[model samples]
Target: MKILSLPSSIGLASKIAKNIGCGVADYKLTRFPDNEIYTKIDTPLDGEDVVVIGNTNTDSDIMSYLFLLDAAKEQNPKRLIALMPYFGYARQHRVYNRG
Candidate 1:
């Protein structure tokens, strides 16, 4: 299994990787002048199990996570696991009033 982490979750991911005695994958993220996101996975993940760690605190973070997930899926890994330390808006499970 391989571990991939976003900038926000690097620390946590490192700890997990150390505990599990696994190596972390290399990836790069860049932003364009127009505020677009780009992701490049440097490590090969073909037929390998992958775990992506990220936190969703804002719209940009969410977008980055989605892009990362899509990129990972494109690589056709054997299995994909998402570890979200913080998931936004997950507590609003009820609707008190309907419009």
Candidate 2:
């Protein structure tokens, strides 16, 4: 099994990997000159279970999550698991801004 994560969830991923005695995949995140996000997965995931963790706290974070997931998928892992600790898009009994 392999675990990957963004900055928002790296600590949690580390705790999980430590508890389960699994390996954590190394990756890099950076921004392009035009301010676009970039992700690079540095571990092999072929035929292994892959788990990605992140929080949707902001637009960049969501983008990072998507990029990480796409990067993982390209590796052709046996299964894909996504762990979203905080899904910020959800709303309850509160009035949203004027539409």
Candidate 3:
């Protein structure tokens, strides 16, 4: 079975992978001087199970996650699981304190 994992940094994802004994496929993200973001999955992911782990630290994090999800779908993974530990805009659950 193939497993694809995308983590924000080397600390968390790598540690978890080692603990669980799962092969980790690293995903790279590059930003240009023009402020454009580029992302890539480093391993063959066709027909594999994908798990994306990311914590929300900036506005771009959410966009990055969405991009990864779309890419994962395109890869035709047997299953897609997005494991986001911290979500930033989650506080926008409802409208309150109307002025």
Task: Write the residue-wise lDDT of candidate 3 on 1-99 in tens digits.
Answer: 334443554467677778877777766777889977777776777887777777776778777777777766777788888777777788886779765
Question: If the candidates were sorted by their lDDT against the true structure, best first, what order would they fall in?
Answer: 1, 2, 3
Off by over 4 Å in 1: 93-99
Whose lDDT is higher: candidate 1's or candidate 3's?
1
The digit string of per-residue lDDT tens for model 2 on 6-99 reads: 8888899999999999999999898999999888898999999999999999888888899999999999999999999998776745677765
Highest lDDT against the true fold, candidate: 1
Candidate 3 clashes between residue pairs 3 or more apart in a chain or in different chains: none
lDDT of 1: 0.92
What is the TM-score (0 to 1) of candidate 3? 0.77
Over the stretch 1-99, how does candidate 1's per-residue lDDT look in tens digits? 899998999999999999999989999889999999999999999999999999998889999999998899899999999999999767668787876
Q: List the residue pairs that clash in candidate 2.
A: none
For every candidate in turn, the CA RMSD to the true structure comes to 1.6, 1.9, 2.4
Counted clashes in each candidate structure: 0, 0, 0
Q: Which parts of model 3 are misplaced by more than 4 Å? A: 1-9
The predicted structure with the larger lDDT, 2 or 3, is 2
